[model samples]
Target: MSHLLNRLTPRRGLLLIGLVSALALGGALVAQHFFGLRPCTLCHYQRIPHATLVVLGGLGGLLPLGLSTRRWLLAVGCLVALVGLGLAGWHVGVEQHWWAGTASCQAGGAQATSLADLRAQLAAGPAQPACDEITWSLFGLTMAGYNVLVFSALALLAGALAGGAPRPK
Candidate 1:
């Protein structure tokens, strides 16, 4: 473990982080397409951070950047990971009914102002899946819960890597 950490340069670490995020995103997509686990609004929202991290990681790894710039990129990645952690935690709470989801997820949107509006809304196709519903789980942990764990670890790793990297002279 120490040998691995010692060899984890910023560029390599960022690339690894990016690869992990991409894998997670791919898994989510596979779950959606192959297994027919439709994502709710919150689930879609949860994907943004991973997408951002993928871009950040790729750029940080590929670019010929100075130590300070590399550290800055990693810092940004850490922040993004924290944001993902928050989103996933919130999603888990919603799924567990600890708090209400958005209006769209509860009671199926704003009460139609009139019959015509109701019909029009109904014609717009099915309402998006409720955020509070757990569409998938493993070992009693929903995907969002697993996301919380993953993002938290990512954030800590990125932060530590960024902070520990030697400063440019």
Candidate 2:
């Protein structure tokens, strides 16, 4: 694995990571805008790590950073990917009805206990789509399920990049 990492320079690896993150975010936007699929709370939450990776990868890949610095950035990216994985997994559980979703996941003020609370919720803008609702799916996997797979791969890739970054002479 280190041998393979040796061939791919840290700069190139970081750039690839950044590009992948950008594509993932862009795809989500396209789905929302072009397809009219409203995003739920968890869907929005899953994008945070990708956004961070875009910045980290851009800085590590494009800047005149030392090899050690690039490796550190890759390590951070690994952690961020792991965080994303957990969030996506949780979302999958919600979609599967394995567990209850967060309060904000209720799309119809289902969490309101009092008439006043319901009134306040109504006064707010339209409720977000329910996190548990599978708005889109492919092969029995929702977007969150696909995100789980992506994040897992990203975590592995970032870890490999960090470990494979050549040691400073």
Could you tell me which residue pairs clash in candidate 2?
Answer: none
User: Could you give me the TM-score of model 1 versus the true structure?
Assistant: 0.87
lDDT per residue as tens, model 2, 32-137: 9899888999899999998998999899999999988898898999999999999999999999899988888988656688999888888885777989888898
lDDT (10s digit) by residue, model 1, range 17-116: 8998999899999998899887888888879999999998999889888777878888999999999999999899999989987766663566689999
Error of 1 at 94 (Å): 0.9
Task: Output the TM-score of candidate 2.
Answer: 0.86
Which clashing pairs does model 1 show? none
* Candidate 1 displacement at residue 49 in angstroms: 0.4
> What are the models' TM-scores?
0.87, 0.86
Worst 10 residues of 2 by lDDT: 160-169
